[model samples]
Target: MARHNPSAPPESVISIIAPGMQIVGDCQTEGTLRVEGSVEGSIFAGKAVVVGEAGRVIGDITTQDAVISGRVAGNLVIGSRLELQSTSVVEGEVHARRIQVEEGTLLNGSVHIGETDGSTLTHEGQSDSEEQQLPIDAGSWHRPVVAAPKR
Candidate 1:
């Protein structure tokens, strides 16, 4: 069943699963979620999902935004933005309108950025040459440093 937060606005909501907790069933919420524990099933949230350091998720996730600083081992679908912090680790497929991976983060799998419907969003770093060579092993992908064009 879907979980609703009555106090949350129609467009955004917030929920938290602190460290030490473990859930083994599907989670469906119409808001944001901050997880510091472990989940072994699918998660569906309307707004955003933050996975804290030390947290681990072993299932699919669907949300509008995601800020991960832990570990995820499943598919991820983000409608707006997906940010992977330096301490984050992900091993799965990703579909997002926008994606951000901080230096030192680890991701191992396929990634499809921008809207699948062919709409463009504000995106950086990803290139067509790179996209064609996706599903890159985490050991092979290197984050490039953009330098200012020399005059």
Candidate 2:
């Protein structure tokens, strides 16, 4: 698969949430995230986020890019791009630099697209590998994806 450009418009990041899994709580990260199950909280990503066809998010979202192919009920902040797939259904506010909606997608909320001031990017937590080693209900969160600081 081609690597997504973090600097690209928020609509460029490609992510997928496989069917069957469910997540509940706040999520923060960099690069890209795809949800195919159910997410019941907030999402904050430095790069981009994608909600799969079978996915559902019930909270706020902040990211540089975003794509919705499922259902979302919250606010969205996209610094660059936002795309809604044909299977997408969003019920919240959207803030982005660019927005695209495919035929058949449903949106019910406010939207703002442009550049803002003082926006810093960062990611935090542990790795999925580590989280997997622990018990299913251990209450550990995954780490964010961050680029190495310039030398």
Q: In terms of lDDT, which candidate is strongest?
A: 1
Candidate with the greatest TM-score versus the true structure: 1
Score candidate 1 by lDDT.
Answer: 0.72
Q: Model 1 segments beyond 4 Å from truth?
A: 1-7, 118-151
Looking at candidate 2, what is the lDDT of residue 13? 53
Q: CA lDDT of each candidate? A: 0.72, 0.65
Residue by residue across 24-73, what tens digits does model 2's lDDT show? 77876545778878777777776778787888787776777778888777
How many collisions between residues are there in candidate 1? 0
Mind giving the per-residue lDDT tens digits that candidate 1 earns over 4-115?
6677675565677878999898777766778899887778877778999988887777777899999887777777899999998887778888999898887766788886
Model 1: lDDT of residue 37: 91
Clashing pairs in 2: 10-65, 10-81, 17-36, 124-144, 125-143, 126-142, 126-143
lDDT (C-alpha) at residue 133 in model 2 = 16
Task: Give each model a TM-score.
Answer: 0.72, 0.65
Model 1 poorest ten-residue lDDT run = 121-130
Estimate the overall C-alpha local distance difference test score of candidate 2. 0.65
